[model samples]
Target: MTKRELIDNIARDGLVERLVANVCHRRHRSLPDLVQMVYEVLLNYDEEKLMRIHRRGAINFFIVRIIENLYFSRTSPYYRQIRRFAQHSDILKDE
Candidate 1:
């Protein structure tokens, strides 16, 4: 499907809001940024993979997996280290 169609369907069905609400209730972070991140991931989807998902009719499963993976990655040590590195760089830049 095209980007416009994917976005339209997501918006019309409130998929992003539902996903964000599900996450925010448990993880108190930037809701808008998280939601944007999800969409950004979706926007960068590989067409072949998307087509395979469409063929399998497991779109919801795919989306939930993506979100769960993103959440788990955020809680991982590697993610924390990367975040800290970014923050350290930002602090250095400020000085």
Candidate 2:
């Protein structure tokens, strides 16, 4: 299927909203980049992977996988800092 078709399928299945909200929640209240991330992930889906996600239940599961991959692929010091901050947020919250 075409990239446009995949994106349309994802949006129509309500996965986009779910993924964006999930990313926002998990990424320490960050939502601004969630849509762009999803777009990138969906556009890069390989044929086998795309078929798997499509068969399972559209793009919802695929979005989950993308988020997982992104979290693990954090080579940037920025994401590392966010993770560190997130880990220590409870104590900082009372300050």
The candidate that achieves the highest TM-score relative to the unseen native structure? 1
Query: Poorest 10 consecutive residues of model 2 by lDDT?
Result: 76-85
Candidate 2 Cα outliers beyond 4 Å, as residue runs: 1-3, 12-14, 23-29, 76-95
Clashing pairs in 1: none
Q: List the candidate 1 regions with Cα displacement exceeding 4 Å.
A: 23-26, 75-95
Worst 10 residues of 1 by lDDT: 76-85
Top-lDDT candidate index? 1
Each prediction's whole-model lDDT (CA): 0.66, 0.63
Tens digits of per-residue lDDT for model 1, 1-95? 77558667887898876876775464443455555667777778986777678668887767767666655576744346444455577799999
What value of lDDT does candidate 2 attain over all alpha carbons? 0.63
